[model samples]
Target: MHGSPTGGMPNQGAATHGLAALLLLADSRLPAGGHAHSGGAEEACRAGLITGADDLSRFLRGRLATAGRVAAALAWSACSASASWELLDAEADARIASPAQRQASRTQGRLLVRTARRIWPSATLNDLAKALPEGSHHPIALGVAAQAAGCTPDQAAMAAAYTSVTGAATAAVRLLGLDPVTVHRVLAELPYDSVIAEQHDWSALPAHAAPALDLLAEQHLRTEVRLFVS
Candidate 1:
């Protein structure tokens, strides 16, 4: 029995490996559908709100601290809970400002799931897929999926923070006519953890979700033509 594989003690070594795996999956460039969404920076560019990499970084970080942080918090909440996907989804919808913006979220969620499934095979992910009703929002999906991936709340928040920054920077290149490398470097200066850590507390997230960033998303949505999701 000394070397037998079957045991109920819970494998610490395997658990460590799992956490490491989660870290990789949570990486921003895991080929997820993030490339399809600009997290509202597209609208900022079209509105001339951000004219350069410096402006893009400021806009991106601002959005991240507000709306992006909220979404990340919801995701973390769902992950830390008993699979309350619907509750989180509703929260995301309620926080969003416009129809088109909401539509973009739902679209991106489905796309992200498709990408996550191929990259990180998980029964929880499959279960969530079956559990989702039509038009589940992206942030909700991200929260549930991050749970399935065994990612920590902090890790999920960082992923989201980086996603917002990268999305805006990428969109700035396309819209404001900036250099992608310069954009990347500009965004790199962002202290995402310091920003995202505001949601590190489980109890404080809901209060933090409503903010000027949400107002910005709402205003951007009213524009006729746009280049990204808010």
Candidate 2:
């Protein structure tokens, strides 16, 4: 549903402009608690799996390949605006392995939903309120929020991909003590093509393949000196 970032064509309807949707997706104070979790990016940094400017591309590419599945699912679902939250939540929950990570997503998701309901009141957002549990997962909340904001699944997917990559890079710098410039450079190089998403379906994806991020995520959870939540 997202339109051109620079607004729509001359005399085109405002709905075609994606500036508002982009702001909503990019806003950091949306109460999603995204600032907390690193999506295992921190653990990778500590394990020496990621390093200076040379490693940025590979690191982000790997991360996107893994975590991008969840993002694709939620974003595609968002376009419908009438998706089943419970089903989608369960689908996303199945993707989650560690108990700590599952809880973290739920905590953030619920908080994000609450924030959305308050800041930008709407029927679709309220519908989500009545549909989901008190504590849904992050992707589930994001799906509903994206729908309410009039963003299509592809647009949602791009936002999700970018967000995951950014969250991990942020965590890497803090946890592994990596240089900020290097982190930003790698972040910038990460491929974020929305065109490759296709039809977004991971129902048959093997857990170990599309989501190897759990290895670092679980490891990070066991560490006593970690900075990020997960």
Candidate 3:
């Protein structure tokens, strides 16, 4: 009888625990500072890029394919390589082109670490905190937190991919006054399965840069009266 990966639990028990953890981490109300930033959706909306649900859908899909893909890959890599936090962080830093986006990522990561530490204490989490005194990239923190919560690398990637659009989608609903049901339906129909597929090379991560998103983030940073932090 072999032990399951989740603290030697049975297969079913481990699966259940992993699912619970995944839901917990994926929840938007986890006090991870995700609500404060709109993942650039606010700026896009203000820039007339996302005026309604249809525009929001396009924005989300593009975001999912670019930034979302990169984030999923990074989270997957981080979950698999606990000891390579520094390298992974560097990779994340390199992928993000905008200074505003970088600051937002670290801010979210810092909040997530603070919250996850109380929920799932582990040496890995402590090591991550020490390695990046300021904070890690959000996906890196998410990957590590997923591992601490008994989730697999694939699960971590899925969580990362899902969040990449969800926050923006939510923001669109608030910013444009779009129908929440319509927004949610668009989210449900996103091509997440294809984006978060398994990757072989952790060193060669996907660098799908969203130049528009980068520009939007920079523009958002300069706006004096903005709704989101990013």
Across residues 45-117, which tens digit of lDDT does each residue of candidate 1 receive?
6667788866777787677667666666666565555455565666677777656667777887777777766
**Comparing 1 and 2 on lDDT, the stronger one:** 2
Sort by lDDT, top down from the best: 3, 2, 1
Residue 6, model 1: lDDT of: 22
Off by over 4 Å in 3: 1-6
Candidate number with the higher TM-score (1 or 3): 3
Please, what is the whole-model Cα lDDT of each candidate in the order they appear?
Answer: 0.63, 0.66, 0.88
* lDDT of model number 1: 0.63
How would you encode candidate 2's per-residue C-alpha lDDT over 1-230 as one tens digit per residue? Answer: 33223344463444554446746775655556788877776777778777654665677777676666556555556545464667766777787777777877788778878886675556666766777757677766676666666566666667776776777777767765778887787777667783226444546432324445666767788898887788
Identify the candidate with maximal lDDT: 3
Clashing pairs in 1: none
lDDT of 3 by residue, 1-230 (tens): 11124676687998899899989999998878898789999999888999988899899999999999999998888777668688889999999999999999998898898898888887788889999979999999998888888888899999999999999999989988899999999999999878886766766789999999999999999998898898
- Model 3, position 66, has a per-residue lDDT of 95
Best by TM-score: 3
In model 3, the worst 10-residue window by lDDT is 1-10
Off by over 4 Å in 1: 1-28, 197-204, 207-230
lDDT of 2 at 91: 73
TM-score for each of the candidates: 0.76, 0.80, 0.96
Error of 3 at 26 (Å): 0.7
